[model samples]
Target chain A: MNKPKPDLSVRIGGLVMQNPVMTASGTFGYGPEFARLMDLNRLGAIVVKGISLKPTQGNPTPRLVEVPGGLLNAIGLQNPGFDGFVRDYLPFLRHYRAPVIVNIWGHTINEYASIAERFNDLPGVHGLELNISCPNIKHGGIAFGTDPKMARRVITAVRARTRLPLITKLSPNVTVIAEFARIAEACGSDAVSLINSFPAMAIDIEARRPILANITGGLTGPAIHTIALKMVWETARAVKIPVIGMGGITSAREALAFIIAGASAVAVGTANFSEPLSTLAVIKGIEAYLVRHRLPSIRALVGTLETGAVIPKPRGPGRPCA
Target chain B: MLIENTIILSHRLLKGGYRLLTLKSKRIAPMVRPGQFVHLRLPSPADAVLRRPFSVFRAQAGRLAILYKTVGKGTQAMATLCAGDEINILGPLGQGFPNVRKDTLPLLVAGGYGMAALYLVAQRAPVKGIVFVGGAGADDILCADDFRRLDWDVRVATEDGSAGKKGLVTRILDAWLNKELHGRQPEFFACGPNGLLKAICKRVGRGGWDGWISMDRHMGCGLGACLACVQKVCKRDAAGRETWAWARVCTEGPVFACRDIVWD
Candidate 1:
């Protein structure tokens, strides 16, 4: 009478991930780069670096800076472009068991839809992650993601182009993240991933200039994990579409924080730089925690936060009357 | 690419704050090439989150060595490590130097600890060539004695004129290329500071010598995933218009052809 394994499989949009741990885009390269280091099939999904319609060289050198608890990068979404990725990278990626979620971006709304339409015909790609909120790029990155109308327009346009599941990666720079999340859901988005790296910069005083060549870069790591959790909690309550939470998730405990806060799944970002096998370790840890808690499935933990509905008035402290 | 716990065979203090660390890594040593590097995950978890990338200085029978200067907190902590300590490492990563013809003369130039990556390249150099070692003073020129021991020609240059020739090593190279090697254009190989690399790349591009340079950058993941270490690369369009694009220093190259790199 052996106990059955805790069900780790979870579905986001239409893509059913074997586990809830996926590698965030930009952290994981096209695929073959990390395949030798870790078993790619074990991952829930592989989100590669953001792709554009044309090959982009990205930013200048000295694009990275190390802060207290994180890293800042202005990589400018450098990629091999859409056609190059399909020809050079896609064939090697097709061999892996993991589903490939192409993270695509563009400078204009028309560009976003056109890119989405191209990926729609690609054979190996399972889903599309719309990177409408990258802070590192100067053009339409955070532009469309921050504004509600712009987010709606881009999501609606992309939704019309591709039949694949769409996940809108939202920016934390917005005043209210839930508003954008709601807009995505209303505009027919299949899912939403929150808290892309926050805008940050480091200074080299002796050099008398910013540490990053781009002057400012997106900050990602443990420093932003707590903020992501808060945003995930709010966005989950706002939209019916599954919420994928990520920001400095290095371990299973930190990832579980998102699950408890109502994230259908979690993506490992900056931690991948420190430990290539971190995402696999996180998957194992999540399953172990479920088994330890006697939970049958990961869904049981989603949105289980107890907000203390009935607050008892302060009774004895300082003898204050209510 | 193997990640294993490697035992430090020896940690000797070299001149100019450099430490010649020898490690017994059976898994890594055999695969390492001239310009490849190993990512060392320091033991201190609280301080060093990002693993430091050190170019493979020398590799031999079941052992590899890295010649590193203690500059930042990561290298400073690396200095405190002694022999018999096991350190975690991931390597022989990035593309190594391109193979050169056995008959071609190999001219090697290095600055500071950047010499660490060039020693292995020089060992395999054919015919006859000169090794240009430069530093702030004589103490900064690493592996000069090692190269000479191999019966290779060695030339030294110090900024303060405390060693062989005064001024920068690139200046010495310029003088040699213009004056002595008038007819023979030796294949150039260099590893040094960005300014030094820039000067060398410019010279090689203009001088018409086959040249390769090993670059150094602040990297997050020594592997290609992080996209942290980027350099501008020169590319030509259909119209032959020169254009520049970002190239990952960790993946596309730690070593690149002179024409491939666009000097700023």
Candidate 2:
């Protein structure tokens, strides 16, 4: 029997990726580190580490703390600034076949605009993944992501300056995530990636203090998979643009849940840290799932949420249906 | 540059909480040198979300060994690995020891689990050399037989006097230096706890000895880009500017010249 050629290609914004499997920002540092472990060319796209207008020292020691099912990291925004990124790291990324998405962070609104404009003209640059959801730093990291209005302002400023596709990464810390999704779409963001790490804390009972140097850090991995799914569902339904979902997608089955919830593509974050070849595992899992279900392409799975699918209501006094 | 072979040799208990896992990969072995390490994927699919880094304890033919103490779910899952089980393994990564001359009197020092890294150096070192080991007690001591079989002069020190000498390994080292048994100044190599390495560095002082020490730090990419595994080093480039540069232990080295390291 002839095995079916898996159709994993996906399109987001103006870019057409060979597959929906992309490395999450921060988790994958420019994609070269894992090149020895797996073929970089096999990936759909590579999201580089977060870049800033100026060099950042990031957080102090004990920056990472391990929890029950995830990890908390307060690694500030450590980078060599935009100039260094373009001059030093850009050339290395050009060697790979996959599109390179530069994850950018800034201290102020103007900083985002200026850096976006600079990256807009760089060769081999695919798009900009605006990291507006970083929670480790004292300023501007989570500031834009927490407030819908401020989120709109930052995305708007960057969108006006660059022709490059804009991917606004949303933080799950906010109460009304759907509202934030609407605000980002209205402000001209080409697409949106939902649910950056959740803010969390871990304590060392023996030491009688927090495990991380920053006292608190952003939690990521399987522990928050459900939360990420819910946020992606709400945000994807609220916006017309594509939503790239990520949380604790360790296998193909988990990633399919995000696609069903309305995500166009999925990013593998903390899972990459656990396995050097996790991206490939996810790709293989998705392919196996497609073959098992006899689906022709991954597109057939996206936004396939069944209306009749059971929706479990919160366990409390029932209110009248809207 | 390629994966020649990969196999799970054995997974067994080391101490009460740790497990020693031996994996065989020839592609990595051919390129591996002392002080380099490989990143192993933990078996847990959810709870542990990062590939744990283990020092290259011993690499030969197509096999490499790693001694890890299971302090969490990730390592505990690693302990469950059985022979023939396929696990993801990345190369004999990071810069290793500078190829020493045949005549260099290599002196190897290890403390506790630090022996995981020093074991390889002892095996590969010149036929005539000495190895000093330190552990909390006899139970914590590892690979004493391996070193003994190699015909290298093996010195053991346990904190509780359950082994060879009573007191810290550094004290044993001081005695060796004062006695000057070998008649020639030895080139020292050490990897262990930070506290032990710090004490050794202080005793040796600047311009006193020629040696290299391996450092351990939290790593993100295991590559140089993340800057998460930065260690202070006194480096001099082409321009002769003696500056403090952040070196990644995963890439630049898990092994560095003793004089180049900035002890804090």
Candidate 3:
């Protein structure tokens, strides 16, 4: 008698993931750091910490300060720049079992294209994750993410440089996320990951001042999981390409919700900080959910939105669906 | 060695701003030495990214324990953890102390929470060694009973005079070295605030003495990439090519020889 194997395969853009779970950029730090703690091979894909055209010193001390139910960091995209990342990080990443997606950030549209062009032919780099939303820096950090026109221009510029699959990371601090997702899609972005950090702050009551040196920080944790899911659903519906949903996923159930909401795959960010094995747990959870539901593959759940699905009415004072 | 497994055995309060957390990981425990640490992901989600590094206070029988002071939200959340919980822990990382020689008289020195990093060495050192511990006050002094149980000479000096000697631990070390410690060759193992370690290094000098110190720095990607935790060293290559590169405190060392380290 043959035992059933778990259906854990997932595809995003042109890359195939053994599982839908991946480590979010910045959180996993280039993949080698966690090697001593866990197996890098078990992960579906490792999205390395954000890289830029040039080295970044990041922000000053008190760069990270903890807040309620989460943390706030103004690390300011501190990386070794493109040359160092390619020379140093990419070589080691090739040894890992999973695909390595290098997350790139830049100060200008051409800078993004330049970095993309540089990495277009490198070995071991499976895809490019455009980190268009970074709140910790001063320059083009959050510029492209917050404005649709800039986002399109940045995405278009990079698209013109390489054939590598592009995944544009979206920022949550926008008024219309669906509009931005549509623009990114039209600009030739292969997939979109939503949403990046929600700009938030925490104050030190005793000091009567903000805890972080940079008064504001990006919020992430279970506190913003729902918000991320909503954005992912909206973006997935707005664009024809895949959506890599991530925000506050700490377990398999939460990951499944993203899949049901139309995310082609999911990224586990803050949950990694809480539990290093969280990505593995999410992958296991997705497999278990698929097996129990009698689904043949994960693709069945991707973009499974039922048009005209009933909207639950609020239990309080009375508003019926139109 | 790779992390074979990880389990949070227990998390309990010890005193003000301090906690005793036990992590059971066979992989980390087997390879860990005194003065090394593990970088733990603080259960915070991605956007609030970054892992916090904690020194390995004690390791035995496939288990590692850390004594951490709750300074912020990351540690506060760590404090709330209970038995059977698990956090992502990457370690047995950084350089640990050189193996204690049988003939040398080992001297273990620490300050405040710094005691946490030195406790294991004190317990493991040969019976002939002396353990000199210091802290802000009596509350800051830790693991005295454990060291005493090992039959090592355990001395305590507190700033507020609420414990052993009525002065700073360095003063006690100075007095002991000049008086009772005369003519003996003691290899020192120390870990504490940079200023305190600097003062100790200055007094001890580099002649006829061998010692190791563990340094601390803000780190990102505990491996090497971010270059957030770089430290200077004193030595240079044969061609005077500065053999002292910017060593990563996370991977290259959390511990280094006293003569090799360049303290600011």
Best by DockQ: 1
| Cα lDDT tens digits for candidate 2, A1-322 | 9987769899889989998989888887776677766888888889988999887767766677567788788877787788778788788888988999999989899999999999877888999999889999888978999976678789889989988988999989898777777777778878899789998888889999987778888988888899999888877777788999999888877788999898989998877765656788888988888889899999999878887967653233212111
In the range B144-239, model 1's lDDT, one tens digit per residue, is: 888887677888899999999999898888888878886875788889998888888888878787889999888988788777787779878779
Q: Worst ten-residue run, lDDT, model 2 chain A?
A: A313-322
For candidate 3, the TM-score of chain A alone versus the native chain A is 0.93
Question: Residue B197 of model 2: what lDDT?
Answer: 78
Candidate 2 collision pairs: A273-B50, A273-B51, A274-B50, A274-B51
Candidate 3 runs further than 4 Å off: A1-7, A36-39, A305-322, B1-30, B38-58, B61-93, B101-105, B148-151, B176-187, B193-195, B201-211, B215-250, B256-264
Count residue pairs with overlapping backbones in model 1: 0
DockQ of each: 0.65, 0.42, 0.27
Q: Is the docking of candidate 1 incorrect, acceptable, medium or high quality?
A: medium
Q: Which residue pairs in model 3 clash with each other?
A: A269-B46, A270-B45, A270-B46, A273-B43, A274-B43, B236-B243, B237-B243
lDDT of 2 by residue, B1-264 (tens): 333346787877865455677777857876778888877655564466556678887888877788877666667677777988877776676887765558667778889878778777877776567888998898767887788888888889999999989989988988987787556756778889988877767655642767878888776556554456777778785699886656668787888877777865
Whole-model lDDT, model 1: 0.87
Give all TM-scores, in the order shown: 0.93, 0.90, 0.82
Q: Give me the runs in candidate 1 sitting further than 4 Å from their true place.
A: A307-322, B45-47, B126-128, B178-182
